[model samples]
Target: MYVLEILWIVLFRFAPLPRIWAVCLIAINLGALFFLDTTYGLVALLAALTGIAVMMVIYSRLGFVRLLGIGHVFWIPMLIWFAASLPDRQTDPALYWWVVVLIGFNTVSLVIDAADVVRYLRGERAPHYRWRAT
Candidate 1:
């Protein structure tokens, strides 16, 4: 799948920080899936899967460019969802911290994605990886 391939690229093709980020995101989402609160976990996964879907579509149209991060736009709603539902999840310490860390990490990621998208808009149009479009 493109998502795994993206993870691989981030892990191997990119530098250390991107590798750590890819792993961290995986850890966070997997934790959500394993959480006792199935509803909370599923909702969180829903937002993430939607973002992956968007990224897949964009990657299909364009190669592995900076714009791929545009999929993370879905995180905007997820963040809002987290804000609205955070108080309830507080009862679950693990899940609560998961949400908190997710918020901080994703907030930073969104900023980076936004900058990459802006750069893509500004004509930095070359593909990041040359291994074939997908």
Candidate 2:
């Protein structure tokens, strides 16, 4: 199932038409809500997971100037939901702090992804920082 999810995401990434991919993404999210089927959720979860994996590969070679930021954008929300869902020994808070955390992370991720995209568009071979650790 995981492998299949990965294949689906890779296919989406390479899809020629942005509209097709967007439609597929929306359909999956809507199906998850309408049918209460976790399969669609699971697929989305897999996509987020793959984003991290792909980021790792890119970062290893190019260093993390932007990809990490983009990842945070997507990841923060998921992290917040997961955190808020946890049972506490004392009491459950009315406000979901986890959701806030997720939002923060997502925003950071978006910034980084955008930076990388811009750099790539400008044909940048190297980032501001040294690719290798000091």
Number of clashes found in candidate 2: 8
Model 2 accuracy (lDDT, Cα): 0.47
The per-prediction CA RMSD against the true structure, in angstroms, equals 2.5, 13.5
TM-score versus the correct structure, for each prediction: 0.86, 0.39
Report the Cα lDDT for candidate 1: 0.78
The residue pairs that clash in candidate 1, if any, are none
Best by lDDT: 1
lDDT per residue for candidate 2 within 14-98, as digits (tens), equals 3466346435543433332432233324533554666657656666666534443344345445555555554342453322333
Could you say which candidate leads in TM-score?
1
Q: Ten residues in a row with the worst lDDT in model 2?
A: 93-102
The per-residue C-alpha lDDT of model 1 at residue 122 equals 98
